[model samples]
Target: MSRHDLQPKADQPHVVRATVGWDRPLQTFFAQVFFRTEDEPDEGEALIWLGTEPGEMLTPEAVIAVVAPHVEMPPDLAERLNAEMRQTTGMKDGRHQAAAKRSLFGSIH
Candidate 1:
């Protein structure tokens, strides 16, 4: 099973977007994460933005390490969001893998 297949279902708020790429100016990977919640879940905020590094898998550990300091989400809730992202996106569903490939390789695949 692909990593995307392990991602959690869309029952609650989850990471809707995750991207990582080269940052020429910074000479490092740039990672971005966007998690969606039902109607202003976080103090009237509908979406949460989190951290990154290019080429590295956007693991929950990484998210916690990077985003936790900036965001004030409960530990359990953050874990849930991380699980959702992993279960949904990390598990490669062929489609996501293709998209990931495109994102990383620029249509080379």
Candidate 2:
């Protein structure tokens, strides 16, 4: 899965979208993550703004790296996903091979 929000509010975000899926053709697992915010357009109305970073293909490790620094994550989960982003960042092709790596999430398949 690939996802990117039009704009992301790292300071005070109101929404977070994250998902994981297997890319059969790529022979790997992929992940997507995005952050957004809600605004009041009128009285008693919440307008969701989808303005954020240009979504791009990121490995599960990369997703966690981006998120961990900006938000408070569960201790166990954060430690796990953030395992190798430091070393693997910007290396998409190599990341795909790490599909068998560990994560807090599991495949439904």
Candidate 3:
């Protein structure tokens, strides 16, 4: 059967899809933060389902905070990530970037 044919019917709970990215070395960290399990696909990436309806997207800082307590990372990494994210997202400074990096990378070393 085709992939669609195998899916649950419309009456079933709707599934939301999201794409998350991380460095290859941080695969386990990402899985732990997002999935709560170490079992991850081999693609070195993750697709998560938050909910059916549109929900507030987690700020990068939020993501970092959620994941930070669970893993080990260097302090500089978090700082650098924050800087990059700030530049990319047009945030005023490293504040949000640091938060997002911490969320994705976990605790700094």
Candidate 4:
């Protein structure tokens, strides 16, 4: 991950999550901030917002704006999420896509 990535603390499970990418089940390229729980991890999450529409790229302000009404959002959370979106989608800066890739693609050579 890049230094600019908005990653949640990995040490513990969090109720809120922010992600930027194509969702397999949702089948779209999006940036999202939502809440979920351990009991029903699959579909329990309450979406604050889906930051980008299909065929649209992410905008950091949108992701940050989505979280604002939900709680007293931390400054770092907003900043990190913005940075991650910028890094991943390259809407601002150019695409540094290596960090954003979900997994290795193709087959063994």
Candidate 5:
């Protein structure tokens, strides 16, 4: 069976995790995100693990809502990031493979 075939049902929740290194840039970013949350008292240093169930259709806004506060990215940069992610994720769909292939080469299959 294909990987997608083994994946959980459309209604099921899929977990996506990102581990960001704690350096000068990341530290400043995290401070902004944690600044508002009162639940997290000790924000000096931590390995944050954000969890969400984004069903079948994954939206850019959903992702940004979680990450935007942490990092300061320009509108153009954010758009580029979202576009790149959409394209990368498109590879998983067999229907888009031909288009993806064409992206690598100048001509369509």
Candidate 6:
């Protein structure tokens, strides 16, 4: 079933749908964010605010902050998500192995 079908009703507080978004840059990698929601989706409204402050970077930590009030996440899920984001960035830059090595054992001298 589609995720939209999983949207929670007022009495079903535990049910949620994951809504994802990304920051658009004029010329660089897009920063992603996601939040789980129980609120009924608005049929014809612009749900996300795309016009962020100039030079604002919506990192995963920022996404968690915005989402904290909306839903509960496992303690490690956010950390995992942030790690995955880092991996994705490295992959996109074609430096996954290098970055992983640096993260694990410091840069090569």
- Can you write out model 3's per-residue Cα lDDT over 25-54, one digit (the tens) per residue? 221112122222235432222234221121
lDDT of 6 by residue, 1-109 (tens): 0011123335434334333223222111122223334444333222333324332534545544544454444466546545544544423323664575467547521
- For model 2, the superposed segments whose C-alpha errors exceed 4 Å read 1-11, 20-25, 37-60, 78-109
lDDT of 2 by residue, 2-109 (tens): 322222335645535443333332333344443343443222122322212223423445544554444454445434434433434444434433443322123222
TM-scores, one per candidate: 0.33, 0.27, 0.29, 0.34, 0.30, 0.38
> Which scores better on lDDT, 2 or 4?
4
In model 4, which runs have C-alpha deviations exceeding 4 angstroms? 1-43, 47-49, 55-57, 86-109
How big is the positional error of residue 97 in model 3, measured in Å on the Cα after superposition? 22
lDDT of 5 at 36: 21
Q: Rank the candidates by TM-score, best first.
A: 6, 4, 1, 5, 3, 2
lDDT of 1 by residue, 15-89 (tens): 443333332211233335455557634433414333323334345455455444333444464455454544444
Clashing pairs in 2: 6-51, 6-52, 7-51, 7-52, 8-52
lDDT of 4: 0.42
Better of 3 and 5 by TM-score: 5
The CA root-mean-square deviation of candidate 6, after full C-alpha superposition on the true structure, stands at 11.2
Residue lDDT tens for model 4, 73-105: 456664654554444443321233333332332
RMSD of each: 10.7, 12.1, 16.2, 9.6, 16.2, 11.2
When summed lDDT is taken over every stretch of 10 residues in candidate 2, the lowest stretch is 42-51
Candidate 4 TM-score, true structure as reference: 0.34
Please estimate how well model 5 matches the true structure, expressed as its whole-model Cα lDDT.
0.32
- Clash count, one per candidate: 11, 5, 10, 0, 0, 0
Please give the distance, in angstroms, between residue 10's alpha carbon in candidate 3 and its true position after superposition.
42
Model 5 misplaced stretches (Cα beyond 4 Å): 1-47, 50-57, 89-109
Q: What C-alpha lDDT do the candidate models reach, one value each?
A: 0.40, 0.37, 0.32, 0.42, 0.32, 0.37
Selected candidate, larger lDDT, 1 vs 5: 1
